[model samples]
Target: MVADREGGARRKPARAVAVYVAGGAVLLTGCASMPDNGDLRGVESTPRQDTQVRVFAMPPREDAQPSEIVQGFLEALTSDDPQYATAKQYLTGQAAKTWRPELSTMVLADGPATEADPAGVREDSVNFSFTLTGAKVAVVDAEQSYAPAQGSYSRQVRLVRDRKSGQWRINGLPQGVVMGKSDFQRNYTSVNKYYFASNSAVGTASQTAAVADPVYVRRRVDPMTQMVRSLLNGPTSWLGPVVRSSFPSGTALRKGAGPLTPDDQNKLTVPLNGKATQVGRAKCNEMAAQLLFTLQGLTPAVDEVEVQAGGEQLCELDEDGAAAVAARGSAKHPEFLYFIDGEHRLVRIPPGGSRSTNADAVPGELGGGERALRSAAVSRDEHTGAGVALDGKTLYVGSLVSGSSLGEPVVRSAGKTEDERLTTPSWDARGDLWVADRDPEHPRLLVLREGKGEPMEVQVPGLDGQIRSVRVAADGVRIALVVENDDKQSLLVGRIERTTKDVPGGKPGPGSGVSVFELRPAAPALEEVTTMSWAGDGRLVVVGREEGGVQQMKYVQVDGSTPEGPAPDALTGVKEIAAAEDGRLPLVAYSEDGIVRLPDGAQWQTVVKDGSAPVYPG
Candidate 1:
């Protein structure tokens, strides 16, 4: 068998290749290299994405030259060698011990261009150097999360001769391995880690909201086992403060357990240490639900997961059981699409969007003509909703049932002008309400508890711009804001950190406070982001414009990575856009032509000839 990556068992790569045994020929893997992030120019695009072929990296020859060793080492970095044992053969004793393939990954627009240093011809000649250069694309951090990066890439590898064998070996290299985007795509596969919302303070399984944290892992290696360890390790740093792992602290896989694999019924039993033996049935079910969600997309489909501790079965969760215990973001289906119709009243359309029926006003005063509304957001449960008055000065909340009257105004904006008032409201899965007051002098983001309590101003520490629109994610741990600054509008995603107040002394308080922090760009490359909505877990469909470009719509990950699917078809005069966390639902938008929806295998069709502000339940 071929030597795997790190320690001889990492058996996958970041990209793809092809080797035909019948023809006995070697060919380079052809993958697109055009930079979508506008990092640089001159990268040529390839024809197509060929088949997936496993590459076997060979050990260094007895008398390898310094140039040969440099090339081989770079190649080995792209292989799925278990533990990267084969790659370490080319490194000196000191370098081998210090090297860590799992530390991080640097990805470029194309395969790095390697060139030997001109100063290699010294008379003493104890060392040689090779410079690697390429256009930066993105980076997979030590946690395996991907983020878009920019600028030129360059690194140097210095080689030295072994004292005893006189063989060439690499003594110095960068902290993490580097590869082209194609290789990264071939070698690694993206997977989601599941965690519960910290906003609820460790509630029961039925009440808890599970959030997804996306990360990358090797495809050919023991990915299931690797993913289990990653899930057990907890959420990534960016999402750590807002989410909690169901797994108990210090809980880990049994020490002598072999690689985890699914049985004939697609049930994978995970053996945890004694730390998990004490959790009651509710907690154990939540833990099993997390495992089932995280490993469902991996190979050999895991339909069931069982948690075992100290040689005894703790709990078992199948698809239906998991759904009942911990509801996932994708399981949410939008029942109706809401928008402001020609009469300026809140109205609803059947969610399928392909129906030919006319729009109907929702129950309650907010949907009636007497109280004109401009924008609105329905709660996750669909039993309640919040709407902004036509003048944008008052925000109202009430029930969705028949004959239900709109309650008193929950929030009032002092902005004198229409443009300087409250933005649309949003609801999180936790049932909390969110909105932004654009009263230029006292601009602030506000949240109402359960859409009925006093409006609390959310502190955004690093937000230097005014929030024009707000959309809290279904998980409730993240919120997206369209922030306007210096005449440009950018889409930013922030963490919703909730902490209980500290008592006068050193004790914890029962009261909780919430704040938004880590406001990073979700669409950094766009010059102006007009509107956006959470398309799914860790994904967004944004309407924005690139520098010196026309308005366009594209999907982006919360971490600022490029999206996986094709871009949406172009629509003109898109003033606002909305999407459901359930990706299968058609995308709804309010363009110049009024309200429209995109159905499966169909172009944008008119939902209403005179409507604006289309939205699905959060």
Candidate 2:
């Protein structure tokens, strides 16, 4: 299976064997009649019973007033119940029926403050508004599209006394739920749902491409089930047109909305509706691959998955098999790191010291004398290389094999001077070369198919800034861009849509290959970004400084959320950063001291004394 670039939709690299525990402990009991012998005299044993407990918040009190009810409802939104049953109790009958918490979510600065004026209050009704004055951090809209929140938000709620029970209840309120930043942190966790590339051809020799759709799920809720159900529901609005799912239309959980349980063997049995029964074995296996990849993030990760339709077994896949079907196309570690060495030649450093240092210039004209490369990018397959000349006016592509000469310039910068010429080059998983000419007059973003075709201009709508750098995600559908406007650099993520027209009996015609993209603001948490690269699983490792601060290295989710895990090591003086889709590879960067890398749990190590423009195969 082909791995999708954006979702890091590749089979996970195989892991080392793990030891097993039975019921969380070892059992060593024997019959007393024979066990009392001297051989067991010194043995000590203890018998213990397993204990389990679950805690849940109590529902709103019956005597609570309108303000108190509103407060409780907002607090309940942070609970672990995915259905928000407790939160609904604070609403009036009609309000509860109309409220759609999933329609959108407002991530507020803090808990809301209720304003109930005496003049606005009647004997049976109270009119008040929840004044939410804090900055909105982010928003999840009705279409499940998550983006950085802008400006402020406020909501008003009116309470009416129930005629039958005399209880104060929320009668009028907003359509979505609102939670403080702290509550959102505690209640929500991000997970990626896997889907096949829209053009993936199943059952053929063609590779399968998988894309990842990241979304937030309720913490402590059954994330496994939520993720699977969300996957079956399909990709969100922005990604819907670029990806495909193996689950058939109308496919749903057979057992209704409930947590999917795994048996003692760690096998999750998913019972689907009848729609899944019609799929063939190969297709069913592909569906299983999606489930396994989505649920792999759960605690006590699922080792196998069993799919059933109408209580009949349809397919089963083990961890290894599922990984094989969704393999990200290559091993997690990169084959080598390529950079411009002191001798002005394209040199390589094999990851983990697998190859000799400063391996001879990638076996071609690029490795020969006077090439004078300024920047370079190696394709994921390591079969091709793209680079920019020292003058930055010409772009070259060449083979990485021994004795192969560099190809003539496929793209030439229109800039009148070298300083305003082309920026660094990047390669996508599809072997497309992307670069931008910095000449303000022309200022164009271009893509060269397979690094050798005619350069095609891609329209980036609403880009009021000059392009600084461009990196395409492995999925080949999204691009991470660093653009500068008014001397301030910003990081942005955009969707790449390829438009083509079918020919009578051939591939897409020349005039049909137009590239268009919609740019969206990303990494709003950072004020200025210098360099960025696509980290595995749709995340980015960025080098930038916060407002009025020094530069630091941090990881940001594609949706603009600051992830909850530990931040990566902070490295200073970084000029460029490159990462492989398989995260096992260390992060390679060009620093003041030279080419440096940060391996997992280790400090930065210098690979070469003088090198620049370090890059890993995409």
Candidate closest to the true structure, highest lDDT? 1
Error of 1 at 286 (Å): 1.0
lDDT tens per residue, model 1, 252-316: 99998758999999999999999899999999999999999889856547999999999999999
- Per-candidate TM equals 0.88, 0.86
Q: lDDT of candidate 1 vs native?
A: 0.80
How much lDDT does candidate 2 score? 0.71
Q: Which stretches of candidate 1 lie over 4 Å from their true place?
A: 1-52, 122-124, 199-206, 256-258, 500-512
Clash counts for the predictions, in order: 31, 10
Give the Cα lDDT of each candidate: 0.80, 0.71
Error of 2 at 294 (Å): 1.1
